[model samples]
Target chain A: MDMRAAVFRGPGEIAIEDVPKPALDAPTDAVVRVTHTAICGSDLWPYRGQEDRDVPSRIGHEPMGIVEEVGEEVRSVAPGDRVFAPFVTSCGECEFCRKGLHTSCVNGGFWGGEDGGAQGEYVRARHADGTLVRVPDRHADDEETLQAILPLTDVMGTGHHAAVSAGVDAGSTCIVVGDGAVGLCGVLAARRLGAERIIAMGHHEDRLALAESFGATDTIAARGEEAVERAQELTYGGANHVMECVGSTGAMNTAIEVCRPGGTVGYVGVPHGIEDDGLDIFGLFMDNISLNGGIAPVRAYADELLADVLGGTLDPSPIFTKTVDLDGVPEGYRAMDEREAIKVLVKP
Target chain B: MDMRAAVFRGPGEIAIEDVPKPALDAPTDAVVRVTHTAICGSDLWPYRGQEDRDVPSRIGHEPMGIVEEVGEEVRSVAPGDRVFAPFVTSCGECEFCRKGLHTSCVNGGFWGGEDGGAQGEYVRARHADGTLVRVPDRHADDEETLQAILPLTDVMGTGHHAAVSAGVDAGSTCIVVGDGAVGLCGVLAARRLGAERIIAMGHHEDRLALAESFGATDTIAARGEEAVERAQELTYGGANHVMECVGSTGAMNTAIEVCRPGGTVGYVGVPHGIEDDGLDIFGLFMDNISLNGGIAPVRAYADELLADVLGGTLDPSPIFTKTVDLDGVPEGYRAMDEREAIKVLVKP
Candidate 1:
């Protein structure tokens, strides 16, 4: 079957092409007919070849789709099921999966491309039974509104995980470093978790505005040391929870600087190695601050977050400030990479 | 009342001087007749005048004594009660107390020296109800055997808290950095917590051997990166939990470095103004290793550890390698600071 697909020919290049549809490869596998896919800031990483794009591989990991085909082993879902796929596909049985740490599952890999990314029309999801969460049928017809749920597949879940890992709780002050979609989502997660104060650090006013909408009680546009001091001022010394969403040396430094003594810094940002100054370890050790966060266990929070979306208790859509057709996927990547949008929704 | 006390009349000069007996000041305070006190590694920090010693305060914080007098407000312990005093005196009603973080309680303060150190015949212990844990009456007669328990007042409790804070549990592997008494105690604590594997890292053969006796399954006599690599090799990559008990920047770094992805480094080491490399925020972000620990909530773990000592479930006494009369207290400090003794017990 010929399916319209967004093909990444190379870095900074994308073209609409007719690609062969995905099929059931294993008894636990399922083929999701793409209904909604979202452009993630992470997507920009590979799109710009900054993440060492495995050439010719489809590149997207946030999508909601209809279960057009279900393997025989699948029991939780069936054909015609509306579902949201977790970014990383995991086998139901594994040490990591047993502990609900799906991202680190030995037998599980991500979805979406040939390497299991989600940029194409038809995407194969391995370990379909444990990795896919059924979406409500009501939101199926409103793909635009429901499209926002796609980011929850990775970004929203990631942000929530950051807050949870950092031990953000009621009465705690939280600080989210970076103004990207994940950072904004972190602010939302902090608010939902009942953080008394949420400080969103960003250099962009527009992004800061979006962060405010996502429940950031305060925003600091400063970078580096100044940014940390501003967060400290807002939180009456330093934040109890610091979420590092931007994967950079500076953002990492900001997290440590802004977290209070006896607080925790949950970092989900993938770091590019930087030299050790010996100060971070000293602060972490002396202050009793817990630093914890990594790959998001998307499946862990999928059901709860999806229920929130269906009931309208939470709106993650504000992060989607731009949208583009599958054919214009390259431009969407450019917009996100250039900071033109917090997140861009892609229509398949 | 005249009492024989180890007095630091001046730097490099300490003599067993006859001093006035201690008195109870607050209603919740108690005056303990010190049966045994410990010369802690920290005690030397001031004894050598490396720390402020101008006030000529008492020089010991680790001690086991009999409650000679109890103020009117004292409820938990009365006169004649045999007790172990936690180094940090806490008011059980404070916010930190409610959360079982007694070491950092709002009204919590260190014992010994300026206020009331245990290096004397009689010592005043403030917040008696919160700061003192009455030992089982059975062990009250065995002062020598229980002298080992003296270190539990500070070092042992601190190590145990380090393990607990890092979330060490059954089937987990842990690395203990530093071979001091506290680090060895941490090894014992990790073992009691059901950790399957414990790696003790130190440079001295004697200390490493002591660590093994304390329940360290393996020993790595290396420092810095080599130490970390040795621990990782012993643990088959890395440990699930790392306890940093040395209270140095180097130990903290080693603990963080040896922890596995998704592991946690519980650091009880009192850091000097030295900065960490921010490994907790940046380097460990992708590894998902959390850095957690600070001043251990010694009050929280004292009862159980004390029980372990009484029940023969744990023998923490080997750490008390030497015992001296009040007159030899200065030599005890020298032994510990010079890395000659694991822990020195001082009897007044």
Candidate 2:
């Protein structure tokens, strides 16, 4: 059988081409017919020629679909079930997975692993029982509800990880660096976690409005020292917690500078050009600050966020400012690259 | 009045010279007659020419003495009371002080601040009520008890800070990097906090033996990758907490590598030449490790440690392996610099 999927030819080049249809090759695997997918900020690393990539490789990780087939051993999910597959797959039984750090699961791997990617019409997901979360039958045909739940695969969960790592809770004063989709989600997570005050730093007036809507108490459209000064002024010194969602050196430094003594900075941006000399170890030590964070364990947070989505308590679909068909995946990447869209969703 | 004190003449040079005796200069100040003082690892930074110093400046911070005079506003201690001044002075009313982060107190200053240094016959102490802890009268005349209490001003307290910041508890498995006095003290601190297992990494057999005496369950006589491998082998993967008492880049890296996913690295070494690139941000983020710690809040930990000393529970005096009279102050620095003494006790 043949299927249509997005393939990466090189930097700035993505194409929808004919590819082999996915099949349940293992007893723990399930094949899902792709229904919706979204572009991520992380995808830009290779799209912008910043990271090397192998030509003709499968692309994309976030996807929601209807399971078309399941191996005999797959007991939790079956054909005809609507579901969301997190960016990473996990076995659900490893020490790390059992501890709720599914990203570090010993036997788990990324979606585009050897077989194919999620941008295709069908995806073969391994560790099926542990990797896929079932969508309610009530929302099976609701496009808006599906769009709202799609981001839980990566962005929403990543933001929640940042908040959790920084120890954000009731009465916490927080500063979020970056105004991207993930940064906006961070504002939502901080509010959900009961932060007393949240200051978001971003340059886009439009995104600043979105951030305020998502629960940011204040916004600073500045960078570097000016941003630090504005955040400090708002918090009366510096915030007790900071979320760094942009991986640039300046963004990391500004995040550190705006945190109070004995505070924590939770960083989630995938490091690309980060260098050792760009960090201020002496300053961090002198101020007694903690630097904590890593890749989000999206699989661990999926079910909880899906609950919020199904309960109608959260609506993250606004992040999808643009929509495209599978054939427009190339233009979707370009739109995100040019900052013309916060995020792009695709209906296959 | 004239009093003899240790004065820094230049790199690698020290002298016992006559300086003006200290007097109460502010309502919150007190004058202390020096009884016992000790050298610190930080002092070696300047003494070894690794860092610049202002020549003719008084040298020394860790000191225990008898309060000879107090300003009318000082209500905590009066004339003739035995006391020890924390290395850092803090205004009790500052937000940081109220949070028990006295090291970062808004109105705080180090020991050698306008007043003459602690290695003198009499020294002026600012914020006396907040920085000076009273010694019980029963142990006032015991020289051995006084020696044990002196380290509470810096080294012992710094080690305690490392343990606390790393969340060390009864069942935690830990690692202590560095074999100097501070590292040895870290072993003691971890054990005091009820850590189940502690692996101390050091190069010297003698220091390793001291680490064992201080409660290290295992010792790795290796450095760098080898040290990390050994620690991993012992802990199955990595330790729950790591104490980095050496400020070198390699020591910090080794500490980070030997910590388990989700563990904390408590670093208290005064960073000298650490750079940003030396850290593995991608790896740290992926593993969810936290880098926490800074200068010890000596004032905050002083009273509790003093209780241990008076109750005959902790004996940190073995760290003071060599003793020097007031006139031999210069030799004390030489002994510590040459590694001929673990620490030097100065008696005036």
The number of the candidate with the highest DockQ is 2
lDDT of 2 by residue, B1-348 (tens): 888998888889888888888788999999999989988888888989887889878989987899999998999999999999878888888899998899889987887735878877778888889888898888888988988898998999998888887888998899999988889889999999999998999988888899999899999998768878999999998987999988877788788888888788999988876674366766677788788898888788888888888898888888888999888778889999999898999887
TM-score of 2: 0.96
Query: What are the candidates' interface root-mean-square deviations?
Result: 3.5, 1.8
Per-residue C-alpha lDDT of model 1 across residues B234-262, encoded as one tens digit per residue: 87778778888876556666776787767
| Candidate number of the best lDDT | 2
Question: Model 1 residue B150 lDDT?
Answer: 76
Candidate 2 local Cα displacement, residue B34, angstroms: 2.2
> Top model by TM-score, which number?
2
Compute the interface RMSD for candidate 2. 1.8
Give the DockQ (C-alpha) for candidate 1: 0.34
